[model samples]
Target chain A: MSGTINHGLAQLAAVDQGFFTDRSGGGCIQDNKLFCPGWVADNYDRYVHPTLQHLVLVGSAVAAGFLIAFALAIFAHRHRWLQTPFLAGTGILYTIPSISFFFLLLPITGRGALTAIIALTAFNLQIIFRNVTNGLRNVPANVTEAATGIGMTPSQVLWRVELPLALPEVIAGLRIATVSTVALATLAVFANGGGLGTEIVTGSNITFKTGIIVAGSIAVIMAILFDAVLLLIGKLLAPWKRKQALV
Target chain B: MIPLPALTLPTAAFGLFGDAFNFVFDGREAETGGVTVGGTSQVLDLAAKQLEVTLLALAVAILLAMPVGLWLGHRQKGEFLAVSAGNAGRAIPELALIALMAAAIGVGLVNLVVALAILGIPPILTNTYVGISQVDRASVEAARGMGMTETAIVRKVELPLAVPTIMGGVRTAAINIIATATIAPLAGILTLGDFIIARNVYGDAGVLAGAILVALMALALEGTLAGIQWAMTSKGLKLKRS
Candidate 1:
């Protein structure tokens, strides 16, 4: 136990003491040259674990947020009186800032992906909840009335009529939440939830431009990829909206 | 605002809430040495710096974004540009943006402000455009009919009507600016984030104190902006909404 603790201290010591500890081999690295493609190529494999961790962080948080917000939206839909309080609660969660949120959670949840996920998930609640509620509420009352006339129960009407109409907005909210979460998840390193941020914030200072560019590009790519996938899913679900767009 | 902070019971971060508050309001002993780290004045200075940068970056974003967003909105042009810009803007990682700006451009108040402003721009621009375009067409038409210029129509009719939405964007920008400013210490701006990031210097109490202060500052600024938004709304619009 002491060995592990000593090793952890040693690691932290090493991080603080050096700007570029492994810079001897490559001329590019030795000079601290910006955009060291050669060094990046050699060290590219280092990012694999952090990449996966980041993916899990962004993915699970968004998924959990959507579920909770969707349920809340449904409840608020049923009981109109619940809307204000729910909005205010989620708004407070959304307002706190992610770094502060992560550390604030440190004492309670302990560090790592769960704490990061909880914070990220809480942040997402407001965006998703607002969008989902608006989407549900925006359903033309006439359409629901027709569904009711067709012998549809309230739950059936909600699932078949209201949710389908709300698809575009819900998906739009997802895209925003997903993209922002991808960016925000980089800060998860502070909580010790590894992500692409491990590369950028490798030390007390970030003198290594190459590391940042590589990690940031991957993160941006991830955000775009997530966004595109969500967009395609929305398109598939709302085919009529697609057809309307084409005209 | 990018979805933001969360809170719960403070645990291993420090001894107790009282201790943390005391750490903020009175100098605290560091873990390694007998050195005193944080106190009321230090905390206040850091808070001021954070607020200054947040407002500065927000002002830069407003100045840069509002004209473009308002004009696009007034003309009903560049919907794709405005929308896609906001979407694309969301994708830029905050850490990456900060680290890269520091690495490439050199670190200082100017660079940090520029980096934070980059974040604030998108939401404000998109919202302003969205808000202005969303103003009732009839009102704008009536303004024009009453011998108003395009500028006057935009200022008098569209802006007043779109106040809530535009302010929503500004509010979003403010939240983002303040949040991002917490990491300004990474780029060498010693805001409240310095306490959080330099855990070695301040220890757990300092870190927790920093977190608490940052959270409170965010809430306070957000509340202030909410008030501004309310005050900016035309009384007619307020009553109509009520």
Candidate 2:
């Protein structure tokens, strides 16, 4: 509603100020606060972002995507009839190009965080679903049977046995999805969702400047940080691997 | 909302002038006329030419990545540098890197290839790393224990085991590179994206047409790679064919 209008107007204003205009001489003159000149301001508006907004968009997408993936993975595994078709369907969804999906989804959902989340979630499902299915299925049948014999219900078996066993692989999938979603989230910038890509696109259209480079670098750095954090989490969760307990 | 009619009117009118240009000076590269036909023709030619470059870049990337990735997989900690460097590499956007490279080496395909090469590296590296790392440890140890040399172990055990995963990574990488390659037109190399970007400047129809072409090109590439990936990786991997 009101938020969409403001977002559009802001982007339009950014475009109109000639800030994203060809080399130099625009509203950017007053905001020469950019880190570099000529080389940076080329498309300043597109690249510039307040750090909080960038993190919030990326963080929320990753968190929500993880939850959705977890639920779908469990649903697919419990119902054999649903497993094959569910996994295959997500696979096809994975192949759709991001921009086309964005455009297609935009008409239905409109351009905003929701569209970006839906798009990213769809892209991530295949990987997460595959990993979760494999992780649970790979859990030793002996272990599941032992739990059942011990009078555990299916839910108890899943919660207490299967999930713990599958945690390592599941975490690995999450790591991949996190890094991927962060990078893909940049495309949302085109819809005026605000992230690192805005800087890169704006920088290219204007005189190349350091601000644009910095912003772009920051985006990359954020992605790297996300990767590192996920890797660390994977390591922490899989201490058995560190202990040399299993292959 | 400009609506469809408003968007269509100008391009439709320009279509008449473009048609006239085709009628009068279509064949000759007449130095004197302000014929719009040349622009349209050049755009088409450039789109095709860019495709050729894309194929070249992709072929080169695959050829180069295969050996390097396979080699990296044999080591105990093969993914160390690949993952770390790739994580860092993702931070540097293709557009910035292209500009920096174009500035350093000048424009055209050289810059495009170099930028694409850098762009192409991460997926190949990550895939090779992941694929090789995922190789069954016992199978690898068994090969090593059988008096197989390190090279033999790689060639016989690790590589075959890793092929599917590595190929999957390649498939993903190829799609990514193709999608990003559209930016090459901005560097003044007239790829399909040039039409979209240029038309974006002119009006929506040109941009729309450009979008259609780019989408088709990307879809065709993805399908081709999917087939290739299926052929290469389907041997042992129980990938449910879509």
Best-performing candidate as measured by lDDT: 1
- What is candidate 1's lDDT per residue for B1-242, written digit by digit as tens? 12333444555344555667788878967776787779988888999999999999999999999999999999999988887778888888999999888888888999999999999999999999999988889988898999999999998999999999999989989999899999999888999998888888887667778888898999899899999999999999999988
User: Best candidate, TM-score-wise?
Assistant: 1
Per residue, candidate 1 scores C-alpha lDDT tens digits across A91-175 of: 9889998999887766666667788899899999999999889889889999999999999999999999999998888888888
Report iRMS values in order: 6.7, 7.9
The CAPRI classification for model 2 reads as incorrect
RMSD of 2: 8.4
Candidate 1 chain B has its poorest 10 consecutive residues by lDDT at: B1-10
Alpha-carbon deviation at B239 in model 2, angstroms? 11
Candidate 2 structure quality by residue, lDDT tens digits, A89-115: 776566664544544443345456566
Cα lDDT of model 2 by residue, B1-242, tens digit? 10111122555546643543452224323233443423456656756775776777767777777677777766756566766655555455555565445543567887677677666667777778777767888998898788999889887778767776777766666666665566676566777555444432433333334444555666677678767666666454645433
**Worst lDDT 10-window in candidate 1 chain A:** A238-247
Q: How does the DockQ of candidate 1 come out?
A: 0.43
